[model samples]
Target: MNFRIFKYLIPGMAVILMTGACSGNGANGVNGNAASGSSGPNSQAPAGKEVKISFWHIYNTGPMKELYDKLIDEFEEAHPNIKVDHAGYGIFDLGDKLATALAGGTGPDLAMDGIDGGQLKIKAGTIVNLQPYIERDGVDTNQYFPLLIDIMKQEGNGDLYRLPLETDVRVLFYNKEAFREVGLDPEKPPTTWEELESYSDKLTKWNDKTKLLDRIGFAPNLGNFWYWTLAWTNGVDFFDDQGNPTLDTPENIEAAEWWVKMQNKYGTKAFSAFQSQSGSLGFDPFVGGKVAMEVSTNNLVSEIKANQPDLEYGIAPIPIKKNNATWSAGFSLEIVNNKDQAKADAAWELLKFLTSTEIQKRHHIAGNALVGNRLAATDPEFMKDPDWKTVTDQMQFTRFLETPIEAQGWGGQMWKNVQAAVAGSMTPEQAIKTSQKETEDLIANYKKTS
Candidate 1:
């Protein structure tokens, strides 16, 4: 795979200054780190004083939960005067609380949200820019995985308003025993979409006499809201430069329709036949000897092994259209800008400590997700893992954010529109056109208010 570097955000000279201050002549500090975390408006906390900052995050019990508490304890111990009051919840609840609290000026001083919402928050002016704090005393870009540096920027002001905390990538997980039974090679997972569909056939089997599907080739959810990845791969987009929604583009319609045809052949009824009983977390159509291949998140690897230790599976980037890519989704750390500069600065210190290489590596070991910072992501310890290394390395080619569109809940709406198309209730052509028009209308409504 070609590791191409896309220039989106330019690292400021300020990173050099922060590296010097934090990493310092102590010679062992993050001075070698290059994020420049203190570059934006109100990025730093007050100097040499105890500042209590409240933080809310979507990280709860798991490896992440443990590591997070440990990191905070260590940070508190290190700073002495800075105490972080932390409140943790599930991802969904975090977003809800942030929306409610920020609106009322009663939110935590620091908060972590899914990166997908970061764009929305920054656009709505719910976040504070971190460039000022990092300009002279921030994290350096060189110390981080370079991709992460630009991942935190906002398009309008080119401000670094958020920091990359943890990230995830998609991988193809397949069943090994199923491959053997079908007389196919289990070692080589399909690399191309065509190969995946063809390999899937080899693993699919049915009881001809009974007219029952004995096994399926693949799961039914691949096409769910993956249009962003497909759109990028095909060099098409569902929005214009003005951020207007354009789901009805010819290329988008083509990508959506192609997948719909595949679902139709598989029999929509067959895919959902067991939906009521099976529900969403269908770990394996393969493990149950029903399907052969699956493309799931890196975070699911741990659960997969725990449930089916003996099941054979391989990890690789999800199949693509033109270039190698998949959806990039993860959680991030940001200051909610409570209008108190001291609290915001203390929050920055907390963000710095949480995203530090030491803490990031600890989080990765827990198997919750990859650290959003650069150095830890590319660290030998990360890339060396047989199962997870490939997934982490693939981020070099990953898209940090999807092309922005409009409306508050437009993404979910678009997802449903596309889901209906895949579930066979609508045609791909119908789905895109309907989604595009609805999205345009939503954008128009929001623009008038602003």
Candidate 2:
């Protein structure tokens, strides 16, 4: 694969200065000690010196936090020479904190970050190029989903800088009870966009006196809803192979128009008022039976179990148009560029241990996450959960939104423009055209500095 470099911006943040450490092993190699002369489960760290690497992640509470602790303890026991100093941060704060720390030369040796943040770090030179380390250790990139691996590569040149740990897939989830209540077959969920709209119309309820929505059949912009995913199902992508914005495509415009029609059908004022009621009451529209169907990620299953255990729900691959497609996002583990050869090697060892099939399997079970490692994700034992199985089965048809190197903060921008269109403030075509120009200017500015 050709690795290409594209420019993009990190929304709500500024480009900070980043520094790369010189490697003793030359441009294409990482600075690290030779591998331990053992194989399989008995791999050992180079004999004498003990190296400690700091690890930071946003999984700070509950089951996920416990799982991280267990994994770190086991890894430390196995590689006695390496000690991990682990810290947890809230997801919202971690990105800014890491940026500030890296800028001041006090960043952790390794971190678990979202793909977008990892990309920003890669561009900033705050993270180490992991290709050399992968080569030196004979790491098998083939063990991962090709699409997952592809996302980690630098835009212009395929230098891998992050290793994905876990990921999630988007699917359409329906309240089976709601379906039955509407006289629709609970077993047969909507398979096409037209069916989705028809079923939604039947399921939706209105208070004749108040003229407000009592229940919504579906909302295009609800949980895990991504416009790009809709476009993808119609064979449209936001960026071309060369990383230029392609939001103005006919398919994309159609997708945008579809959402606007949904808004108009429900009446934007009534829809917004209904959403406000849910928010005020701390109610989940889907779980509270206010929404018949929702486009959501797998985590919604666990959430439903926790908040409304008796709610019967069914998941299906998202409704398709001309093509079958879904969107996915995940967190990746990355080694930071700290100018320390020994620590970099230590971090590499830890990365391998964490991403190993067995460890990945255990982690997935403990934290209830979709494993990024292909073997663990496909393992029969892990795939036993019907909900999880539904998600994993869609992996082949799932793709990440194309965030060009230049459109780093495109997600927020796209959301804003789409919302404007849905609210009738801008036509679908105008919204997309505005997005394309804004994205182009963002790229241009990024190029000027870069």
- The prediction achieving the highest lDDT against the true structure is 2
The TM-score, computed over Cα atoms with residue i paired to residue i, of candidate 1 is 0.81
For model 2, residues 6-49, the per-residue Cα lDDT tens digits are: 32223333232121221121222234212212121213344458
Candidate-wise lDDT, in order: 0.62, 0.75
Cα deviation at 380, candidate 1, in Å, is 1.2
Error of 2 at 235 (Å): 1.7
Worst 10 residues of 2 by lDDT: 17-26
Distance from true position, residue 96, model 2, in Å? Answer: 0.8
> Stretches of candidate 2 above 4 Å error?
1-44, 116-120, 154-156, 280-283, 443-450
Model 2 global lDDT (CA atoms, 0 to 1): 0.75
Model 1 stretches astray by more than 4 angstroms = 1-49, 119-125, 145-148, 207-211, 222-225, 242-246, 280-290, 400-410, 446-449
Candidate 1 lDDT, 126-181, residue by residue in tens? 56666665675756756655555565554324567677787777677777778778
Write down the worst ten-residue block by lDDT for model 1: 1-10
